[model samples]
Target chain A: MSIEIVNVSKRFGDFVALDSVSVSIPSGQLTALLGPSGGGKSTLLRIIAGLETADSGRIEIEGVDATKLSPQKRNVGFVFQHYAAFKHLSVARNVAFGLEIRKRPKDEIRERVHELLNLVHLSQFADRLPSQLSGGQRQRMALARALAVQPTVLLLDEPFGALDAKVRKELRDWLRRLHDEVHVTTVFVTHDQEEALEVADEIVVINEGRVEQIGSPDELYDSPANDFVMRFLGPVTELGDRLVRPHDLQLLTGGGEPDAVPGRITRITRVGFEIRVVVAVGEQLVTVTLTRNEFLSLGLQVGSEVQVRIAPEVGAVVGQPRLLGAV
Target chain B: MASHPSTRTRRGPVTYLVRLLVIAYLFLLVAWPVYLVGKNTFADGMDNINGILEDPDIVHAITLTVQVAIIAVIINTLFGVGISLLLVRYDFPGKRLLSALLDMPLSVSPIVVGLALVLVYGGRTGWFGPGLESMGFQVIFATPGIVLATVFVALPLVIREVVPVLEEVGEEQEQAARSLGANAWQTFRRITLPSIKWGVVYGVVLSLARSLGEFGAVKVVSGNVLGQTRTATLVVEEKYLNFDKGGAYATAFLLALVAVACIIIVSVIRPKEDR
Candidate 1:
């Protein structure tokens, strides 16, 4: 069962929120909707969830038209950005609510609630209210609550936005594992490019309600369609009309310029296991990565002349200009 | 209100004067009435020499007043919360107009409220007069009339309190619940209900307080028969008219004490979120 969003558009009074956006979300794969704020990423998710309707378009799940379907009939689970669990209900009750609403057998609901709670690793805190849970725990509870319904599709809007960095990373991995075991059609939205790269099987980069590009992280990173994809994927080292990985450049051995690009050392700083060295060519400050021993051997202070070279044919090419609306 | 830098900072004379004047105005306008109600009701033996605590009729009148208020409040709680949910959750034609009309009770004079109800069910020439009285309904100049008047005076407070909170909650959580395959009623019971429970509680409390002290409307409609439609306020008026100042004071004191108690209880249970 796949979701087909065809020529979807939305207008709010005077402002057009989405303009002729279309995407197909295949079943059993995790898709990330990446965009900047007001880029209509969340709006598209809401349309899929049927929280908001498109002004003109067709939405279908598994060949069944869902264009006019209410949210309840859409049969899609949504985890909101702000962990919209029932604040008054305990975690167990919150998870059980979906089942209860579906009129599942009481015993079945009890079993499912426990199972979902265990899935999210929140079984211990199942009796506590949502207000009492930390942000991470609340998000897990919301996910568990969404999962309880056995929905065919799961949509999340900025699921990790409220979480701290470490927790965000942990939950991103957790979501990937959950998606694997459940094997459900899942679509999640996030502005964090790293998160989209790490968690999503295919990232659909959206900009102002339109799709910019859609591909796997490695495919996009190794062969970027444009400069936006390259800079967005990882830190870059830009040289003459070309961008290369920082690690591609090596320091020269001799005092004279090696048969390569030559420039004066502008700055150096330690980063994690490696040190980054900046070389100035005219007005440009090109960055290169080096080991501690290599940096020490060079013994170059600020403004010391140095030689650097990058194999342009091997790495990424300078791609298209970034479209203004390509969030 | 201007915020001066600090106690140690330099201050303008105008700023200082404005702050002092506002404080005094609040103290006089709001605090002093509360203070008088508390003081007069709790006066000692020397103050009680005026017989402000010893009249059995006044005591009985206060009891009747409270009974009517409680009935009015309970009925209002049900209607107000129901109507508020309807206004906040549903989208129907004239919904905006219906919502705006909820505040008609608050805007209309209490005496006008009583007259309007009397015109509808007055039993003399009212809209429902013949039909109701033929079925043995003693609505006008009766206990039901008093309750109807109090209810008319108290209906809007609850709606005002509950509506804004419902607006803030929006349709998000309810839509979320329904999307989980919850039936419409189940969605409302589970999602919409809990979200607005605090707001409902606060609205009901305020409704109770206003119902307890409803005088103008109740006076106009309740055919003031002594010891019957004669509520605590009417008893005080009767005593004062007879030149029984001490007895009037006693009756007024009893009524004030009960009203104060209801107010305190409501204030305590008002929604902490204040929305």
Candidate 2:
């Protein structure tokens, strides 16, 4: 089921949590609400789930007005950042909770519970409490529990946020694969840009309780709607009036006169498969990335003077004034 | 492990002296009384205990105390869980004021609580007593009056114990249950209830102990009606007044035994909860 959050606004006393935030999430797609902390992405997700009520707007689920409906009638599965598994319940019973509350037959509940445990690869931990499992395992169990009800929509608030980096990556890939298999309308919130880029079909970047921009990962990176989205996704360099990514800038070996912009190299750092070269052009610092072979051929090093050239097709005019400086 | 010279110097004879003082204080205040009571009750070859058990008034007092304790526990558990949930989960105007009001029972003296209940529900002169009596209900100088006073005295114990656990567990699980098609009541039963089960147990046990041991409040409301209003504590006081030393010791021994049992249960349940 598609979720349409229209002009939704919520406030906590004097603080605004969401302000006229509207977004249309398509069915059967994994979307990510990507933003910094305190950006109201979680509030929007909670509003859609009916776990929170908006102060001044409406939400429609499957084209039906769902603003007044309680969360129980919304049929949306929510996985919290901190597992939220029932601490006193066995893993199996936790997964069976939704079905049990719906008054499903005992046999059906057991079957679904077993099926979910197997799906999350926690069959052996069926009898174990949530505290017995690792952070990643608990989140997996939480996911299984959320999916047990076969909800119309699935909402996950930083589902792998508490896990370490390695476990987080593994779960991200696993969640992507799981979404492919289940294909429920899924919306997950995270501040991790890499996670949103890797897993989501669409990324909704939020800032200060408003939607900065929403688009596919490549679309957001290549042609950001504004300076905030550009700076938020990855490194951006300003060239007079236009915005360009670090990768879009090319560095020539020779300090050519009159044709290329002359810049003094300040730092050269090798990061994984690419080499980053920070060059100073006047007061602005430009970052350029090159392949290992290209760096070797250019013989680029710190304290070296180089010529910088912005590619012809790389420039995208930033729609708004820069809200933040380049990081 | 290497011990720093500064740390070693910090732990002087004063620390050891303080530890000894605490030990001596506890031994004198708690252990000495318990030992004396145990020795006195069992002193005279069980004759005192047997006579106290055979007395109908004593037996009736024990039954009444147990009945009131059980009823108080049930009522407190329901309202305690509900009120604690309200305090922890929701934000509202005067929330701090309501929270402060919850501590009234804990701070106010039990005798004062009895007087307040009497003022509210005693007789035709009371605030609601005449209307209640017209509706065929008697509160003051009756079992209901005794229970009201006891409830007022013991009301804060359960709420105090349960609120911290509810705050620690948070509203995420309840929100998750709601999203999973569980209604408010279902969410409370499946998620909230289980998470706060140990807290509720500790609270109810505490309330039970307080209710059973209550004398000051029950004294004012019960009017010490023999066989009807005389609770276990009241019987002990009565036995003392009558100069029946053996009977008083035996009843006090029984009350102490039950209180000790409650402490033991709490200790057992607490360590498991920590895990």
Candidate 3:
């Protein structure tokens, strides 16, 4: 009912591709393998899909030895980084390919292909070849095809990577809904932190071919296991040679400029609902996101003496503060 | 802030130069031959080339070439795809060696390929010629020998094309096919073939072209039986030897035309990227 990967290590010649990677994905849950490129996330997904075999370790899906199984025998579904749909077949035919291979009654396969295509909201395009579909549609067709067999586990590798920004954002929500409806154990690989946060129930952050951290998205963002996870989870910039997020700082209104505060409002960014206030904390200017009403209320202009609050208790000291100012 | 998509990517001059050089070289070599063949095939009924156009002997040679090329291409396609699937998907002892050996045809000279076949089948005392004769079969200095040479020469082309396409093709569709209760044959027939169909077609057509134009290797094995074992290229050579310049040119022109036409069809029918 679940996938259990244990002590899996893959090596390509001398380089360690996956070092002792181990994790368990419970049935009916969506897990995200979040990492940078070459971080072994795709490697892990491929191993689970039986597209790759590890140098050492074990994989069990629903209490079966999946590591030893051929991809055809694993009963696991996979969606590649590209949709990888068969270009020659119509969408319905591609979806029914699995059923046809299984030698199901032809009528049954016809019924199932229609149902699956409808589920993916691609019923109208079912008769068209895969090449004619857009990127998002192709991905959905791939999903429908994978699901036609009613696989026990489903794996996707960067399913939205090839899409544009709008399509990628749209597919993220659609995919989550699809995963919820299917209620099958699934894992997807992604390098985008926002994608991992939005779609996955459990996010496993990987770095240098090893799992750096694994937890709920909020937990990992709030309390990262180490520096890498903290830096990776959100938009962070070097502040006084220390990592800091815009929301981490508190702005005080009318509190006399804190003694020794670095010189002032050098720039402003109009962000529709919010005006980003830029403060030159030294040679470096840091942008602080704020609402337009808040900026109007401040009524401050260029060279306005301002006091900015830094929660020292939260921001970790990274290096020499004075030296950063000189730069 | 959103950045310029074009400016976001920066390629070094070295990469640019390499790409341009390859494009130019391909246009020069592949494009030139293709243009010449196509131009002559449809050249405005010029009377000057009439002798070359009307030679019935050349028509016979063209027919012979097309027949052999079609048969040879079909055989190669079947065996090539079978072997490519085995190489990319399955694992067994000496798999690495077998994979490397697949390229032997491409690396070994065609002339030498003919010599190898001859040595194996008709060398003063071949390992199989006598056995084949006892079984009322023949492999050398006959039609079978011509076919053997053609197959050996065209073997690598299809496998090379199919393997990469198969490797890039996702395993999921085939896996999905199997889980749906498909047997091995069903998965191969439904999923594997569809996924790599375009690639296989392109490869087969290219192989056919090469088979039609193949000379030295097939010549050595065919024993040059006129109208029987004599292929188009051999026919062209015989016409040229007889000082029938017009007939030789016509045969050569027709063979070239078929090769060019096949390539054009392949390009036109090739699947577009991410279609």
Candidate 4:
């Protein structure tokens, strides 16, 4: 289901958790509420799920007002960061909880529970208590439980936030595949820019209780609305007065190009297939990313004098420096 | 590198001394007195126990004590779980004050609690006693009075146990339940209750022990009427004061058995539940 949030505001004592934030989440799309910690992304997701109340706003789900609806009435599935598994209940029973509460037929509840457990790849652990499952398995069980009710919108608050890094990556891909198969309008809150950019069909950047920008991953990365959005989406380094991606800056052995700025290489670190070179340009530090082949050809090392310029094709295509500052 | 020695195998003289002191102190304060009570009760090889079991008044007193204790535990469990949930999950004015006040029963003397109940619910001179008696309900110096006293003395035990568990368990699972289309009642029944089950059980056992052993409050409010208001604890005092030390020792032994059983049950269940 599509979700339209309008003028939502939330306050906890003196702290403003969400400030007049508004965003439209399209139906059947995986959207991420991305932000730094305590930036109100999770709060927004909770408000959408009716787990939290907004001070002043209207939440319209599938074009119907849901601001006053209880979480049970809203029909939005929610997953918590800590897995929130019913510790005493077995995995299958946990998955069947919503159906049981809805008074669904016993046979149907069992069938649905089986189907969901299989979907989450946890059919074997159905009879085990949640504590017996690993972190990833528990989170998957939580996901299966949330999906058991066939909610219109699936809301997850840092669903993989508690998992280890390797498990988090696996779950991210798994979630994307699951979203494709189920096609439920999904909204997940995360502070991880990479996770959002990698998995979400659309991204809403929130900061300091306000919506900073909203767009697809490439649109947000390539055309950020302000300095915060740019700095948050990926790595950016100061070049003279403008902030530019490290890979966008090209390095030359000597000052040849008219627009090239001279700088001294301060550090060179090889990571995977790329070489990250930090340059001291005037008083500002700029990073230039070079391919491994290019770095070997140039024979550059620390303290090597170099000239930095935006790549010619990129500069020509953009027609101006990518100035990502407060706008 | 050499492996470090295990600390368990390295106990020093200080540790031994401390362990000895604790054992000696427990023996002197608890074990010795309890042993004497058991010995005295069996001095005639179960004759005293069998004799009390046959006495109609003593049997009636024991039955009445069990009934009062069961009722008090029920009331306290319901009230305790409800108050604990409110304290842990909701916010309102005077919440801190209410939380602080829940421990009053634990700190206040049982005699004072009974006197307070009498001052409010006593017949003839109590605040609501005359009106309540007119409406066909006698509170002070009656069965209800005894129940009230017992309930008041054991009130905080359940709340004290359940509140910490409730706080530790948090509201996340409850929220998850609600989000899965479970209503408030279903959430409590299926989610909240199960998570706090151990805490409630521990509290119920403790409250049961306390209610069974209640003496000062029951004394003040019960008026200690023979066969009607005299409980197990009251019968112990009555038998001792009347020089029937054998009967008193037998009753005390039974009460002590129950209390020890409660402790053993809790200790047996605690480690498993904690895991």
Best by TM-score: 4
lDDT of 1 by residue, A1-327 (tens): 499999999988777788898888888999999878888889999999888889999999878899999888888999998888887789999899888877789999999999998899998998998888999999999888888888888999999999999999999999999999999899999999899999999888787667777888777767776667677667887766567678777767465543366678878889888999889866677898888887888787778777666643545656322321121
lDDT of 4: 0.91
Indicate which candidate wins on DockQ: 4
Worst 10 residues of 2 chain A by lDDT: A318-327
lDDT of 2: 0.88
Give, for candidate 3 chain B, the lowest lDDT window spanning 10 residues: B40-49
User: How high is the CA lDDT of each candidate model?
Assistant: 0.81, 0.88, 0.80, 0.91
Q: Could you give me the TM-score of model 4 versus the true structure?
A: 0.95
Better of 1 and 4 by DockQ: 4
DockQ for each model: 0.60, 0.82, 0.30, 0.86
lDDT of 4 by residue, A106-218 (tens): 99999999999999999999999998999999999999999999999999999999999999999999999999999999999999999999999999999999999999998
TM-score per candidate, in order?
0.77, 0.93, 0.71, 0.95
lDDT of 4 at A187: 95
Which docking class does model 1 fall in?
medium
**TM-score-best of 1 and 3:** 1
Q: Runs in model 1 with CA error above 4 Å?
A: A237-262, A290-310, A313-315, A320-327, B1-79, B82-109, B112-152, B163-172, B221-232, B244-254, B264-275
- Sort by DockQ, best first: 4, 2, 1, 3
- Model 4 in CAPRI terms: which quality? high
